[model samples]
Target chain A: MKRVIFGSSWLPYAFLAPQILIVIIFFYLPAAEAVRASFYLENPFGGGSTFVGIDNYKDVLTDDNYVRVAKFTFWFSLLVTFFSLAIALLLAVKADTVLRGAKSYRILLMWVYAIAPPVAGLIGVLMFDQHVGPITDVAALFGYKMQIGVNYNDTAAAMIIISIWKQVPVNFIFFLSGLQSIPKAVREAAQIDCRSSWRRFWTVTFPMLAPTGFFLLIINITYALFDTFAVIDVVMKNEPGSNPMTLVYKVYLDGFRGSDLGGSSAQSVILMALVLLLTIFQFRMIERRVHYT
Target chain B: MMETTSSNLEVEARAGGRRTPLLSQRRFWRSVGDHTVLWLGVLFMLAPVLLAFLTSTHDAVTIHRDGLQFLPGDHFGETYEAVLFGATGFTGKATGLVMTFNSMVLGIGFAVGKIVISMMAAYAIVYFRIPFATLAFWVIFTTLLLPLEVRILPSYEIVQKMGLLNSYTGLILPLIASATGTFFFRQFFKSVPDELLEAARIDGAGPFKFFVDILVPMSKTMIAAIFIIMFVFGWNQYLWPTLITTDEGYYTLVRGIKQIIQVWVGANIPEYGQAMALAILAMLPPILVVVVFQRWFIKGLTESDK
Candidate 1:
């Protein structure tokens, strides 16, 4: 009995054993392999890989299409973050203070957000498929001949809209929590001081909501850059000018579609560098501004 | 005391019948602006689902004639029938029992596996004073930074090597553990009081009993939170499943929906009304879950704010 009790020091390891094993097998091991594959021109389906050094990285940088995609991705992330946060903040303030049936309204919002992005992507495709888009109808009402379809022609704008719509609920939830976290006394005190509503929000409420905003920015950008391609693939299929098409899709096309794993591995490496640089900046730069209190 | 009375008077002034200065009138106007903005935001957020609902009720002929509007057009049943039975002139079997079961198997299996592993790891980290505990915790947590898409290549290779592709386990395995769940559970277990465990130990309770009896009960809310999250994540998964399973028999609902919609789009033009009806149906289960467990979901988000 004593031996069993003492021997139980390994219980944490035992409890943790399954999770550690899975993470190693699934995430870490794969991530390490991805990095290694980035360096080599790999053809696993065919046989093995050849060492290509930094050629993949070089191709990703020097290529005009890669440069254009990188540019589009940056702008798309920035614009989506801006619009989604702005609209969400507006809703949060209204919901916190004056909206009736806020609970029901929020659930409605959450439901939309929780719908899988792929399904939402399909909805976007249905709504915007050139001949069928309701938004195109609206555009026509304004005497514009613009199409709302999910082709390569408008994928950049389509991606931005898709990202914004999908993320609005998440941003709204964040802002709602931020609004609730503020003490009512602070608003009352501002009222007593004869502060205007705009002044009060700019000075007090906005500052309090900063951390939530910061967190949303990081989460939103990462999701926009990484998780969006699958939705794009589903909706757009093999659109010609889809922005920031990762090495994943590029690899998918090269190996499966083109049967050239070498080029795909190189593309994947380039994609890794682009993502790593952004992630490091987020951790190193923006995280410092997050006010924990 | 003065502040309290003054605030009470303010409430009274606002509530009770009285006329105030133009300053108050301006404030009222500002609030009107706020309300307009808020209502518009709500309208925008709810617009897609509302559009889906409206479009689904109308036939292709109405949408073709009058455009997408919320007004009913008396073809809701017909559109659903067509979508379910491929009457809108699309190919392949209409999505029914087989697809839903496949989705359920994938979602429940992955969610259960993720939560169990997360809870055990969380319990171990908090209770046992293990070597490299902090390092393990941080390393696992940091993996959340890399999106699943970033690691798709390696994951595919691993799945291929294990010969799990096209199997239910293959559909679920790559997603069975989540770094976010560990982070949530670790935070939760850290809050469990040491005294409770001390009491259990003095009574000659073993670690397993102590965990089962004391710790699990204490962290029910956190577990519920993780469970809902993992369940939703697994249920909604698309790309990884699409990548691993090329077989239609193994397709989850989302993958199946994509396949059906792609075929619909590839034809001359999409059957907008029927497609919208299909999208609405796909959204129903998760929406029901949201309505049923909203309180837990909101509480989980707020609690984790700490």
Candidate 2:
């Protein structure tokens, strides 16, 4: 798009060769293979593959367990996106209000962003350890036993809590930036027009932050769907039930553990379609609001 | 808003002469409320890690028997030493130190590889006239939609066919061609002034020379920011490495920490202390990077979206 150009086409090709080769080999080739494999029954032992003509898709779509996992994934994504964004917005509002030690508060809150999801899971395990975890002991003090090992709901709750904890820093940073980006004059004008702080925030500030909120909504859902794989894996490692499986975890489980190549590939294709829709939505819908200012 | 409100309050206080005490009292209470909530938020975020750190210092038997320990224990050196240098009692493989080394290698390799390749691709797209360049960019951009989790099965097949299982090249190469980095670099390069390139051309510098001499130097901050993000991302990868590496020698710290817990079956106590220690160790580098490069990390997140 620039007016300036280097005319040597070979040089450009030479520069682009490594990236193009890697993308073709790693990304495009595998993606094409996944799409192809979704339509076929492939033997796990590398014997051969037979074209099944949508049978794989039919099986996956009809499976009750797959439907359950999809439902769980939907709720998990919703809870995580909502709580993380809400808590982060609250903290950002509080932090924005303070005139002293704001930098210290930001730094303290931001370090959690660096902790990986798996590591966060490990911390969650330690914090909610059935025998030695602090939270379990606290629950005991209240006469309510918190058994993550046996209870499916507890396991799900642990997964959601850890996911939200890990996600909060990123959301907090974005929300803080969003809060700061609102011009002071607009808030003052709203304050002069509206007497109550609640009304001012609801009318002027929250509407102004809608774009950031929507952007974080898409991002948080994407993250909970794909990035919390380790959290779920760690939390459910010792459990004897299949109730906590997210869709991505189901892909790994069905493909690798159960050795159902065609079924898992079909699931993968469906997941790919879902992600494709999310990506297109993010770019085509949310991008306009992102660049509005 | 804050300045205007405060100034207005001060004006009213001077006029009334008795509202000064009330105004100061409100300010005092507001600060107290602010600090209280901020500290509570900090505790909510940090208590888990703090508890993990405390648990890491205690002996395994004590932790299992006595529930949770509120205070630091004296076994810090012994537990960390064993966890870092000694193998798990069950598997006589590498220690957490080795896994940490493998993780460091993967993280650095992944970050540096993505930065180099993406910069070259971006330079080509932005600085030169090439055929199908827009198409190439879009093709790379579409890879963002196909995360490794979505295409795990065939990606594993591709790696298996290439005989890259359990190798560093297998670990890093497939994950390195990131669209985020390429898009980020392209946007950064597009923002570079046209006059600079024109001047460089007038001075008889070739594209390669100009790139190395001028553009790379100019992009140091962007590179640093991207490096922090990509390194943390690479270090935190779970599913890809779990599928690719079958050998214990290639186990990353993230995967190794999980293995430590998973391998302990039956009557074994699961070495909660060492696992906690390893978790802490795994978290150190990325946390350090974030604390040190806080500004760049923020810029990487906010700017890359744009």
For B13-95, candidate 2 gives per-residue lDDT tens digits of: 45545557776666556656766777788999988888888888999899889865778999999998887788855246878
Give per-residue CA lDDT, model 1, range B1-306, as digits (tens): 235434543554475335666656665555556556655776776777788788889877677666675776688878877665553343355354456677778767887888788889877776666678788887677666666776677788888999999999888877864576777777776666666766787898888888788878888777786666666678788878878877766767777666655566456545667767766766777667756888776666555531
DockQ of 1: 0.44
Kindly report which residue stretches of model 2 are placed more than 4 angstroms away from their true locations once superposed: A44-46, A238-240, A290-292, B1-19, B265-267
| Candidate 2 lDDT for residue B222 | 99
- For A1-293, candidate 1 gives per-residue lDDT tens digits of 01122233768888888888888888888778877776877665667778988877787678786666666667766787788888788888877875345675577566665688877887776566556678777777998665433344465566667767887887888788789888889778877886577788888888878877777777777777766665666556444344345334555666456655545556665566666777787676455774446
Clash count, candidate 2 = 0
Give the runs in model 1 whose Cα sits over 4 Å from its true position. A1-7, A43-45, A148-153, A241-256, A270-292, B1-17, B21-24, B61-69, B81-91, B302-306
| Error at B190, model 2, angstroms | 0.9
Highest-scoring model, lDDT: 2
State the C-alpha lDDT per candidate. 0.69, 0.85
